[model samples]
Target: EPEVTQTPSHQVTQMGQEVILRCVPISNHLYFYWYRQILGQKVEFLVSFYNNEISEKSEIFDDQFSVERPDGSNFTLKIRSTKLEDSAMYFCASSRTGNSGNTIYFGEGSWLTVV
Candidate 1:
């Protein structure tokens, strides 16, 4: 089975700094998403992209955050002016379709620590 992959498994950055997390989702998947878990908190959806546009985004996905599919296989998430509250395990996920029943494969996760 194919799996999502991420780069820089862990990172430490100071507050107000910019951070970019990279991912390569399952090649055949059509829907891509970004989710974050702040330490012990439940996983929270940030945004979803499809057909080269944003399909949906949660409140947590503010101006400070951006997503891009820079190429055929690369998906990236950039956080501008990071804050302590932004620290979390960022998961990149993808599914063949947006249907709720479809399985969404997730990357191991990129851990971000804001100082």
Candidate 2:
């Protein structure tokens, strides 16, 4: 079995600063995604990447946000500018299939805190 792993388990940043959350998904998986959960809030989808491009994205993934697979082995999400409302536990995930009925697995998560 394989799993997604995220780095810098926790981070705190200034309101206008940028932050990049990193992740390494299961090697064989083809679909990777970024999701987040604000404290006391439900988890929400951010973006999904496949075949080296964005396959899907939620409205929450605005110009201020971007994602990339810098290398064949790792995936990353960059927040152009942090906002107090951006504080949340960001999760990296992967799936063998991206079908609606299929399941996607998640990493432990990277907690982002903004002031």
Candidate 3:
């Protein structure tokens, strides 16, 4: 089975810098999303994209954050400015159907660290 792929598995940046995490979910999946885990914290939802638009986003997705699907098969998450608190493992996920019955596939995760 095809799986989600993420580039630059790890990143290091200074506070106030910008970072971009890339992901490519299988072409068969339609809805794509970005999630994060702050070390020991639970997986947190960041944003949901469908039809090239943002369907939903959590409060954590503040003004400093943005997401894009420049290519139909690839999705990207951008942080306008990085913060020490922003250090976390970001995950790319996708689901063929956005229904309760369908399951989503998640990427390994992109680790981001800020100094």
Each model's lDDT: 0.96, 0.94, 0.94
Instruction: Give, for candidate 3, the lowest lDDT window spanning 10 residues.
Output: 72-81
- Model 2, 104: alpha-carbon shift in Å? 1.1
TM-score of each: 0.97, 0.95, 0.97
Which candidate has the highest lDDT of all? 1
lDDT at 75, model 1:
95
For residues 1-81, write the lDDT of model 2, one tens digit per residue. 678999989999999999999999988888999999999999999999999999999999999999999999999999987
Q: Candidate 1, residues 1-115: lDDT per residue as tens digits?
A: 7999998799999999999999999999999999999999999999999999999999999999999999999999999999999999999999999987999999999999999
Of 1 and 3, the candidate ahead on lDDT is: 1
Backbone-clash count (model 3):
0
| Model 2 CA RMSD to the hidden true structure, in angstroms | 1.0
After aligning candidate 3 to the native by TM-score, how far in Å is the CA of 97 from where it should be?
Answer: 1.0
Model 1 misplaced stretches (Cα beyond 4 Å)? none
